[model samples]
Every structure is written in C-alpha cells, then in structure tokens.
Target: MPALDLKGCLDDSPKFRKRIAVYEDSIQHFEFSLKTLTKLTRLQVDSSTEYSQRQQELATDFTSFAQSQDDPIIAHALEKFGKSMIEVEKCRTMFVSRMGQAAYNPDVKPVIQNSHVTETFISPLEKFVKETLFPIKELKKRFEKASDEVDSVLSRYMGKKPKDPTILETAKELADARKGFYQVYMEYVSKLNDIEAKKKVDYMENVLAYMYTKSAFHHQSYEILKDLEPYMRDLTGLLNDTRQRHDEETSESSEYQDLCAQSAVDIYNPLNAVSSSTVSSPGITVPYHNTTENPNKSGYLFERKGGRVMQSWIRKYFSIEGEYLVCSMRNTKTSKDDDQSASYNLRVCSIKLSDSYDRRFCFELISPQRIIVLQAENEKDMHEWVNSLRMVNQKALNSDKAPPPLPSLHRRGVSDVTPVIKLNGFSGSSGTVSDSDKELLKMVREKPGNDKCADCQAREPEWASTNLGVIVCIDCSGIHRSLGVHVSKVRSVVLDKWETESIEVMLELGNTIGNSIFEEHVPSDMETFRINPNSSPIERDLWITEKYVKRSFVAHKDDKAQETVNQTFWDAITEGNLAEGLRYLARGANVDYRNPNEHLQTPLHRSVQLGNEVSVEFLLQWSSNVNEIDENGWTNLHYAANSNNVRLVLGLLKRHAKADIKDESGKTSLDLAVEHQNVQAVTALRLFAFDKQHNSSPANSLDFGFREAMSSFKQNYSFERSHGTSHSALDLRQTKSHSPKESSSLHETGSKLLRSDSSQ
Candidate 1:
C-alpha cells in the first residue's frame, strides 16, 4: 500500500470541504473582531462622543458570531476562535484599567493634555495589533483546527481498517482528501508561523526604532519646555511626575510585549527545508525510541533498530564535511535500581557533500519516543532545524552577517608630573661636619689649651674645647671625655651679663688676650718686609704703613715688645704657613709657644695635627723632639695616631717616639690607633716599642740596670693602668712578685711615668 500524503488532501479534496469552509469563516470573524476592538479603542481614546454606543454594538456583534455556529466540530472551532477574541477583550480591559488609573493620577494629567506626546505613545501598539499580531493569530487558529480534523479522520481510518485489503482501499479513497487537507493546513500554518516569527523580529527592530524616536521626542519636549518656561509652574511639576510614571510603565509594558511576541514566534515557527544550492550540505538526524515497551519483551531487531534506520537514512541523503560521527546519549533511567532499558540517544554526523568539502549536512532526533528525526542538508537545513525547534535566530549563530564586536573598556590615564627638591648647605642631621665646619675644626684641632694641670702646664700647649664641651688636644680628643660643667672655651666667664653683652665681653677679652699674647717684631731691613708693588696699593699700604709699621716701631723701641712681636709673627706662620712657620722655631722661637685664643700648639705639634707631612718632616729634621706632648697631654705620636696617617705614625716611631704616651684621657698612641681600627699604625707602634725593649740589657750595670729595669717596670704598670691591661691586672700581679720596698718604688715611679707620659 502506498503512503498517504495528508498535506495534499487538506489542500485539494472537496469531501468534508464544508469543514475547511467553516474554518475560513471563523478566521474571518476573528479578524473582524480584532479590527472592531482596535477601532473601538481608537474612537474612545480620540474622545468621540458615541464611543460608548459603538463599543456596545461591538460586544453585540461578537456575541452573535459566537451563537451562530451549529455543527459540533465547527462549534468547537468557533468556541476556540471566540476565546481568542475574548483574549483581545481581556487585553482591552487591561488597557482601560491602566488608562483609568493614568487619568486619575495628578502626574499624568499634563501628559494627557499634550496632544503630540500622547499620540506618539499610542501609535506603536495600534500599528502592531492591526498590521501583524491580529492577522497571525486569526490564521493560526484556522489552520490548527483544520490540521486537527484531518489527523483525527486519518488516525481513525488507519487504526480500524485491515492493512492487506480494507486499509489499502480506504487509504486510496481517503488519499486525496487527506493530502488536500494536510497540504492546506501545513501551508496555512507554515505561513502563519512565518508571519508570527517575522512579527517578533519586527517587534525587536521596532523597539530599537521606537527608542530612537522617543529619544528625539524627549529632546523636542525639552526644547518646548524651555520655550514655555514662563507658563510651566504647575505643568513642570506634573511633567516630572508623569515622566517618572511613564518611564516605569513603558519599561514594564515593553518588557511584557517583547516576551509575548518572542514566545509566540518561538512556539509556532516551522522548520525550513534544505536548499539545493550547496554541493555538500551539513545535516543531522536522530531516531525516536519505543517508550511504551519493556526492553526484554520488545523483540526489536538490530537491523530494524531506530539507530540503524537513522544512520542509513543519514548516510543516503545527508552529506557533511567530516568523516567521524559525534553522538550524545541521554539516559532516561530513573534510578540505579531501574531496568537498563533502551537508552534515548541523539547522534550527529558530519558527511562531506562536495569534493572540495565546502558543504556539509546534519541530522537530529526531534522526538525520540515517536521515532521522528529532523535532517538538514546545509546551512539552510541547519536554520530549518533551528526553526522547527522554534528557537530564536540567535544573532550569535548567524553566518551571513557577523555580530558587531564589543567595545574595549580598559585603558590607562596620563602619568603624574611633579618636581623634586635638592638639599644643600647643611650636612645631614647625623652631625657630620660641612666643608666650612671642617676647616674651622682643623684649626681648633691643631692648638690645645694652656689651662692644664701643673704637669700639663709644664708642657705649655694651647687647647680648644670640643663641640661636646671637653678641653682636649689632637690626642686627648681621640679619647672619649666626660663633658665638664664650666663653659671655659667661651672667651669670658662673666657672671651677670646679658647674652649680647656677654658676646661683646668675650670678643673684647679675646682681643685683649690676642694683643697681649701675640705682639709684633721688626725685621732688620724694612725693605724685606715691604708690601709687594703688584699688590692692591690701598690694602697693602694700609697694612704695611699702619699695622706692620706700628708693630715694627714698638719692636725697635722695647726689648719685651720685640720678643712679643717675634712670638706673634711665629704664631701667625704656625696658624697659616707651616714652612715659613718653621723659620721662627729655628730662629730661637719657643718650640712650645701657645696662642691665647685656644689651641696653643707648638710648631711641632701643629705641623703633625694639620696633616702636613712636609712640615712634620721639616720639624722632625730640625731636631724637634718626637716625644713632645701638647697641652692636652698628647705627644707628637698621639697627633699622628689621631690623624689616622700610618706613614706619619711610622715616621714618628722611627724617630723613637714613645707609643705608650698617655693623654689627659689616659689613652696611649697604640690604644687610640686600635680604637680607630688603624691596623698599620697600631702594628708600627707595637714594633717600635718592642725594638726599644730589645736593645736594653739586664746585667752590665746593676744600679743603672736596676733603674732602667725599674723604669721599664713602671712604664708597663702605667700602660696597664691607662689602658686596662691586655692581660688582667691580677694576672700581672701573680706573674711577678717584688720586695715591698721595690713595689713602693715601682708605684712611685709608675705615677711619675704616668704624669710624664701625659705631659709629653
């Protein structure tokens, strides 16, 4: 028996043709009702005087149409058709209810009064129902009813008749009717569904269009409001309130409309057929399984299996780009304990449809339980499958036109530009000296004070106070000293003086001391002391004729004045020029001469303290004692140690300078060197001391030897006292025992040695 083409019967047959006629008639009524309702709404909104009377007439017409239907099938169809009209009424009631609420609102009154704005807002809904939604709805009902009738008639005939004779006979007789009915129904529904889907697409497009139009309208309203500012006192308030309400309502309504339109389109759109333009097409098909049977009792053969049927059909009709099959299975077993029945699986395959493999095909299992499969031969076929499923045309999936790329959101801002500061003048607050302070500090370091202990006074050195207020020489300065209470470094110690007065008094005292202590002397020939001819005449003449001439005159007249002048010149040379300064010492100038203003360094000590190696060599060569001590009890070796110069220290030691000489703080040159980590200086000092000890003998002269040995013993004792012993004092005592008389003598000698070491 041949298969029946139900689509043809629905389209062409005359038998049961009245049913088709009734369906068409009912659709017309549905369209009329929609149009009537739309017209009534417009009339009412337009403020027509007879709108109430017209609405009454429309309700009567709708009731008459519902009552006129007589045939049960036709009546049932009409009832469903009427229900659609009732839905329109329900929509109308909702609109009226919203409008009534809007009318009563104090906010919306002014918006309603604006004729332009109100009309613009109502136009889209009016156009939508009239042009798209109503027509689609009417057609959908008509075809859906017709399709149902055809299916019902065919199903009854197929189920009751025998397949061998009655079935074939009946099917042939019914073939034309069935085909005609189905053809009309499918064509109509397909077209209706297309229209409905297009309406959804149109809705989104219209929304975008409406948004642009509304934005422009808002701009125009702003301009109008600007021009009407003088008359806007109450209207502006109402406008603001109405705008708020309108925005909220429009947002909600637009959302609802979008969802409804999209749903209708998604649920009804028909799958499109594959196009023949492509050589190879992409397609997929899935077979339905028998859900009603138990897996063990079904007797389903492998060759006759749904999967095999689907695979065969796909291989025969579908062509894809790939060779391998991709299949997904959805197991419907309810639990772990449930029987392992036939699994409902969807298999997709890609078959090469062209020699170039440019085109492919696909297939899908649309209804697993019904054994229905959907096939696609190319891109168009894929679209058809998507359409059959009533899915939205996901813009993301479309190949014809690519989606616009999303805009970039990440970027950086310009950098900050500010200025930096440069520090100068002051050294860091760590108390390190600036270059100027270092110059002054060097001068102070060269000279020590004269107001020392009797023994220190004998040394006749000048001392300056440290920044910490302790009086120290170059050597004593290396040792940490206790800060004394008296401010002796200040020139004057006046008890009852103001700060300014004290400063002036100090300056006067300093000048008095400087003038008294540093007197001028004259040379034998005035020409030798004459100002240079090339020098600035005024400045040179002033110094030569006034200061130098007066001092010269005083020197020539008095012997005391002459000696004072000689001392002053010697002091000036000692402070400034070490070479010229040495001439004074060679010419009977005191080696230990001290200036009044602090730092009373002898020529020898000053040279070493100033880090003047040439001057120091000159002084040492001139037979200046290498062991000479300053006012702070610092010897020349102490100055070398404090200077941190290993060459100068070795030079001094080579000249037989005592390494163990202590300053007022009781630090020897070796101790000071070690404290400062001057390793070479410390080694040289130690070697010199060792050499001195090695040259001395123990037996030749008992008394002289005993005295020398006693001196050595005292020197070592004083060294240990000044610098806490490298070996403990207890160890020193235990190692050597002497008679009480010798011990007493050693103690006396040790005290004297300590004093002598401090002085030199």
Candidate 2:
C-alpha cells in the first residue's frame, strides 16, 4: 500500500480518514492471526511430547510380555522385537526434542545456534506491534488535535477585518499552529508507513522461519531414525547373547548376591556420615555464598514508605552501580508514582541495620535529604547488602574525587537545593550529587564565557537555558523562565540534573559564542541600551525580551542572494566562525543544504567529518535534521563513527540521531564504531538503546564525559570574553545618552576586536 501523505493528514481529507481506517482494520486482523498462530504452535509442541511418551509406555509393555514367553527361540525373537521397538521409541523421543527446539525454545541462542520460532520470530512481531503499532494510535490523536487547532486559528485569521490591530498577533498564532500541525502530520505519516512496511516484511520473515524450523525438524527426525537402524539390526544378536549369558549367570547367582550386599553397604556409609560444620545450630556461624567476581550487588528489596497519610512497603529492584545506589520500580507497568527510578550517591550516605522498624531484615540508608528504610529477603541478604554499601562508601571516601557532604536542608530553602530526580523508582527526596554531576559542573563552568551570565555579564552565573545554550544569573533566569520553556528551557547549573545532550550544547556554545550570535548588532551606546548585573528588574526584562524573544539585535543581511547566503554559511562553518555562520542563517541560509561540490554533504555532515563540534551544535540549535543523509546515504552519525570520533558520535546521539539508520554499505553507526574498535562509542550507542528499551528519561542517559581536545578548538578560536568594559548599574541609570561619535567608535572597535580574535 502507498504511504499516507502529510498534506492529506493536515487537510483532514475524507479519503485520508477512510484509508487510515482500512489500515487500522488490517493491523487488527494481522495481530489476531499472529497471536493465534503462536498459541497453536505452543499447543502442537506439547501434543508431540505426549505422543512420544505414549509410544515409550507401549514399548515397555511389549518388553514385559516378551520376557514371559514359553519357548527360548520364540522368546529370543520376541525379546529382540521388543528391544527394537524400544529403539524406535527413542528415535521418536529425539524427534519431539528437536521439534521443541525448532518451534519455541527461548533459551536457544539466536547467534551461535539457529533462531528459534519464539525468540527470533514471534518476539519481534510482538515488539513491533507494541512499540510501533500502538504508538501510531496516540500519534494520530495528537495529529487530529493539531489539525483542529490549525483550522480554528486559520478561521480567526481569515475572519479578521483589514487594518485590525490584532491581525499580526493572530497571523503569528496561525503560523505557529500550522507549523505544529505540519510536524505532527509528518510524524504520524512516518510512523504509519513504518508500521505498514514492518508488518509486511516481518510476517513473511517469521513465517519463513517457522517453515524452516519445521523442515529442520523433519530432516533431523530422518537422521536420528537412520542412526537407529544399526541399533535395531544388532538387537537380534544381542538377544541371543543375553540368553546364553543368563544360563551362565544362574550358576554365579550366589556370588552376585554377595557383591550386591557389599555394594549397598558402601553406598550407605557416606549417606550416614555428616560433617560437624554442615549441622545447623544457633551458635554456629555460616559463611555466606559469594557468586559474583566483583563487589557490585543487585537484587530486589522491599522499601518502607507511605503516600500522603498511610504507610506501606513497596518492592523495588536495587543495584549498586559505581559508587551510587540505584533503585527502580519492580512493576513498571502498574507503577502509579511518577518517580520510576532514583539513584543516591554512596559517598554522602551511611548504611546500617535498623531495629527501629517493626519489619525484620531491615536496614536504613541515612543521607542529608531523607532516610530510606529497606527490607532484604533474609538475614544473609540484609548483611550482604549492608556490607556491600559500606564497601562502596569506603571506596568513595578513599578516592581522590569523593563528593563533599550534602548541605543541611533545614538551613536553606528547598528551591536552592537540587530536587530529587527519580530514575525509575517509586519514592525519593532530592539532595546530594552523584560523582558524575561534579565533573559535569566543572566541565560546563570551564566553557568560554561560562564564568559569567550570558545576559548582563553577571559573575558566576548559576542558571542556564538548556535549549539556548547560555548560562545566566538568578535574576536573568527568572526572566528566561517567563519566556516559557519552548523559547528558553531554564535549568540549574548546580541544583538540577542535566541531560547529556543539554551539556553537549552548553560545551559547544557558551556565553561568548551565544552573545556573538544573539547580540551581534547591539546598539553602540551599550550603557544606555544594555543592562548590567545591578540593572533594575524592569530594564533586565525588556532587554531580554528584545534580545531573545523579538530577536531584534541578531545581525541580518536581507539584501544578500539566497545562494550567496548559503555559501557564506558553508564557508563560515568550515572556517569555524560560528558567529558569522549564524548571521548568514539569519539571512535565510538553508541549514540542511546539500552542497553538490562537497559530495552532497550538508553542513552537519561537513562539521562531523571535520570534527568541529561547535558547528554541529549550532546546526542542531537551528533545528537541522540529524538523520539527513549525504549523496552516499550516510548520516552525520555515520561519518562521526567511521572517523572514530566518539565525542561527535555521542553528541549526535544526544541530539536524537537515529542510531539504526544504515548507510549504502548496510552498516549502522554502531556497526562502524565496532569495526573501528571504538569501545566508548559502542558503549554510548548500547546505552542509548538501553534507555529506549526501558523507557528511561533522556536526562538519565550515561554521560560521555567532556574531552580535553575541545579546549584546543576553543583556544584556536580565541573565545575569551572582554569583561573589562563593564558599566556599573549606577552609571547606566545616570547617563541618559552619549555622543553619536563615541557610540560609533566604541561599536566599531568592539566589532574589530571580535573579528580579529576570531581570526586567531
């Protein structure tokens, strides 16, 4: 079937709805049929087992009847026949075993052994239905909602009279709604097409596998029966020999009886004797079983906690990863709490057995934020968990980079502290940093211009706009938050958990680089037009709105030709001059333009190939598609991994680059990374996959730590901000205006400084 079109979806075409309904019906039918097939296949395997057992029973009965035969010759023949029947029964039993392995054994290894019907075939069908098919229904609902919103906005836009004061605002809203609709429409169609294509190939592949398994079962049965033929032929001779031996054995019966009695005594002696250590006693100390090669421990534990009023215990899966204690909900599907997972820094917590609780086998983990009460399976488990925590905590304390003690909650406001972020847990309170957070803070603060606020040039900015890639003071952060999360996603530099991708953006574009793009055309009278750290809240708010919201100061060259603008963007990025490149983007350069002169590579591809992360970050902020392919159908991720640049690979993945996209060689980014032995890159990709499988929040993805090499790039660009010319907030309010000549001179000099510094 042809894929649904976005235009049809956005227009809400009747034909589109009809086609979608038909597709939905087909999907339902396919699901029903596949589930039925799985159920019947399992039944068939069970039935075959029963048939083999029945045959074995008949063979045993025949052997008993043969032993009661009257004549020796006839008895030998009958006995030989019974023995062959038993051999045939064994062959039948082998058939059942092969059939089960071929049909539905999950334990069968898909790599080293042939793919089984369940793990390789049926499981993918189920996953595709769950992960792909079901999500399409939700996307359709959102698309319809967006489509209706566009209609409503468009109706208002068209109904307005000419020269209405609200016309511009209405037009902007209409445009935004239309843009939202288009995005949802495209996503819906993409998912619909994906599921449609998957069902076709998946069903055929699964059925082909099922047929192959059946063929293998029959082939193996033939081979096994063929091998049994020699055993059947030898049965007649075996029966004759057995009759002759029986006659001789009758004479040695007394000797056999004596040997049996002595053998029984020998077997009983070991059974009767027992080591003193093996005996159970209240005073005895038993050694706990240690199965792991490493110190890390993971298992289920019941934690005591309560809702708003009533207290109860909830089972959770807990594990020690590095120097942190991580816990996740035991039943993810039924979990009602939004906190599905959580991790605590072992360096800031102490673990000990607790008798204060009524529950037995309980321990308490005391931290600055809250105390967690956990119950283990038994006495041994409780001891092991406590000992493990102690060991990890001691290791952290002995390490050179252990985190400092968390601050007391009672001494400060809750807003000043980091809120507890649950990874996949039921209950938690926020405080303390995992060791990774410290390194993250150090790396981000070390960025150019990061020591001060992007706005007003305030010292030691403690907040950041994750989307805009700029740090700001607490005052500017309040203004950023007012702009709404869509425009500027404000996050704490100290008190909040930062996602890996957000940090990548921070590392690439700090205050200096961000200001160069956003404030490229700031008025020359900086004291009059701009605000400082001590500026009034009103002035700060107005300046921020004009700079970020209205984007009035961003340099634009409307007169430049489209081709010239794009060429300048390409050139500026190649030269690592992001400010100039961003200026060209403002002039209407295509961020995703595929230049034929460079093997049809987009700016993103070129940046990754050149190992310039700043350009890549700029393109991403501009909303360039990370999955866009070059002339060879290779994404920027492919280029990064192929070049063995793990940072670029990680950065791309953080920006939501599709890891499964294959190049012309049918190799994914992971495949290329493996080929190059990029261990870190491979680990990053695998972790991304794990996050998806567990439905984890992207904020918790493993951070591929910052690289020292990026500092060299920053040095080459000379991005050090000039903070010497700061005007005091007092001086700014006193000076109403300055000479036009003085303003022009200062602006010209600052521009020259920026250009010259960038050149170096």
Top candidate on TM-score is 2
Candidate 1 residue 760 C-alpha distance from true site, Å: 26
Per-residue alpha-carbon lDDT of candidate 1 for residues 307-406, written as tens digits (9 for 90 to 100): 5434432121211111111221234443443322222222221112222222244333333244333344334434443332222222223345443333
- lDDT for position 135 in model 1: 68
- lDDT value for candidate 1? 0.40
lDDT of 2 by residue, 23-128 (tens): 7787778778777876776676557656655665665666567566554334444444454444444334433343332322223421222224555456766776
Clashing pairs in 2: 340-424, 340-425, 341-422, 341-423, 341-424, 341-425, 342-423, 420-430
Give all TM-scores, in the order shown.
0.20, 0.34
User: Top model by lDDT, which number?
Assistant: 2
Query: Residue-pair clashes per candidate, as listed?
Result: 53, 8
